[model samples]
Target: MTDMQHKPNGWNLPINQMTEEEWKDYFECRKKYDIKLSDEEIKKIIKIAMHFIDTDHDKYMEESLKIPVPPNLAISYKAFNGLKAMKKFNLSLAKETYPDEF
Candidate 1:
């Protein structure tokens, strides 16, 4: 699919093209629990996620799958949120850093 056709879930526009409201909505949707992450923290997490996705997708996926679901739905949801954010941000960074690959 063309880059324009393959946006992250719930993201109709590319990350770079998103408006402030859209960006906020996107992140808010991914936040499944009350746990708040600062913008800087999110950026750091995304950077780490991108590194893992670039250097060791297989291992990352394996480890991600091993994350156990907690008894509390909120906890489980938050974990899912974190993973989803990581993957989405990683894809965005990859596309930016390696445009030819896309």
Candidate 2:
């Protein structure tokens, strides 16, 4: 979020954990910028995300317990998944849009 031009107060905190003031800031910040995804793109993300959750997540969690400190696995996993989705989406979109670049 360091790269964000506008971010809510306590953006690092989970939505349910946020204060009312932070929620207000969040809504206001949301109005400042938007990245609209196509319906197909959204569906693509959903499919990819669900596949990970259904197929790989259990194994990932099982393996993670081997580590003494997984650094807030719930939050870390969500963030990692989000970044992974973004990277996959970007790579896919970029490849289709700029085939020559690859």
Candidate 3:
């Protein structure tokens, strides 16, 4: 069997293992935009990044639709809205970083 342990995707680390440098870079890259992402928000971003490493952009978008809306109406509304915005942001970032794939 092929060993997928040392693949290019850095999935071996914990999902939330974003470094300070990564956080800075992420904000810097989007600095011109009006978007602001909190640390909690970045977790979802990282999750999407990891997902894309394993799958393709189209598959990621399709899977995002299946995210369960939160039970609390207020939270559910905000979460869904944030998800939509983040999806757009991530897509743009992906296109810039990996033009061939996105």
**Local accuracy of candidate 3 as per-residue lDDT tens digits, 75-99:** 3332344322332232333334332
Model 2 ranges off by over 4 Å: 1-20, 28-34, 55-102
Worst 10 residues of 2 by lDDT: 83-92
TM-score of each: 0.25, 0.26, 0.24
Q: Can you rank all candidates by TM-score, best first?
A: 2, 1, 3
Per-residue lDDT of candidate 1, residues 1-102 (tens digit): 123345343343233346556555545533332233456765665566566776899756643332322234322332355323442222332333333322
Name the runs in model 1 displaced over 4 angstroms: 1-34, 58-102
Model 3, 72: alpha-carbon shift in Å? 39
Error of 3 at 65 (Å): 19
Predicted structure 3: clash tally: 0
Question: lDDT per residue, candidate 2, 1-102, as tens digits?
Answer: 312343323344453344556445444433332233576755665566565665698654433322222224323443444322222122223323332221
RMSD of 1: 14.9
The Cα local distance difference test for each model comes to 0.40, 0.37, 0.38
Candidates in descending lDDT order: 1, 3, 2
